[model samples]
Target: MPISYTDQQIREKAASLGLIQEGADLPRQLRGKVVAAMAYGDAAERHQAPEPQLAGEIVIHGSSILIDGEHFPWLVAAQPMDIGLNPDGVSTVRLTLMAASVQVIRPEPRPESEH
Candidate 1:
């Protein structure tokens, strides 16, 4: 069975992953940030091969994340579910999206001048 997490738990998890501030708006914080996404394959092909990394700016429309003009459903109501670390030792979180379980790498912060 899939584990269900509360909103507070989600927030805490995101914060711990450095994906959000203690009380910041998740969608707002992630909007326009550049990210690299890896969409996990189906159960049958999951362990067979890895998906290519897609890099693009985050665009939140309703409950979806738009990257390179493609719309990816965002699960957890625009919040990313903490999925722990990857084999490369990089921290990761599952967007819990549609059939595609997207793992978004930490977004690079823009320069102070851009803020």
Candidate 2:
């Protein structure tokens, strides 16, 4: 796996996307959401990976969403179970930003190596 983005990079990108106010403190838990958004080409520059890929884990904290430890206050997701989606079939969850016109997702696949 590649190294994760730094606080500065994440912050700059977040600000550029208007996800957070400039110089705002992004909680450590929301990084994953940011990454997912960026990976989905939410940035002003649309050159993110053309292919959607799984990179990190999504963690839900009360009403907060964190990715790889960075908190995303403006993003929310649909719990698979709440929507009657089978966990064993498709574990991916739909995440949406506060007012953005699109949705992004982080794919969760079983590790075949563990089998």
Candidate 3:
């Protein structure tokens, strides 16, 4: 069973991610502003690289969003929720978007003293 949260809950979560401004309308602002989209010069070539797909059990439990078996607390989600199927014929749920975001993760910043 999935959990549900109120709009206030979602608002708070989005705020922590810096996805919304101090006084922005949470509902209206989230329409297309928070998601990351890819623009490719050639649509065909883009698809050849890797396509996004949705193949996981997405549910809201309490304040967490559970995708596949991963427990992502609070409405933390990358819009354009990309996905891909596992080559294996297993029914295991997998969050492909989470995996793909690896390229964007930056190393922890060093202290000012170290710089």
Q: Judged by lDDT, which candidate is best?
A: 2
Q: What digit string (tens of lDDT, one per residue) describes model 3 on residues 14-111? A: 67667776655677657333332111223445567466666466664544667677886444444543345456753443332334334556889999
Per-candidate count of clashing residue pairs (backbone under 3 Å): 0, 11, 3
- TM-score for each predicted model, relative to the true structure: 0.24, 0.30, 0.24
- The candidate, 1 or 3, that scores higher on lDDT is 1
Which lDDT tens digits does candidate 1 get at residues 1-115?
Answer: 4434455655665666588888765574543231211122233455765778844444555555566688763434545555565456554445644434657799799999999
The true-versus-predicted C-alpha distance at residue 7 of model 2, in Å, is: 0.7
Q: Using TM-score as the measure, which candidate wins?
A: 2
RMSD of each: 22.2, 18.5, 19.1
Where is model 3 poorest over a 10-residue stretch in terms of lDDT?
A: 33-42
Off by over 4 Å in 3: 27-115
Model 1 scores a C-alpha lDDT of 0.53
Q: Residue 28 lDDT in model 1?
A: 45
Give me the runs in candidate 2 sitting further than 4 Å from their true place. Answer: 40-115
Candidate structures ordered by lDDT, highest first: 2, 1, 3
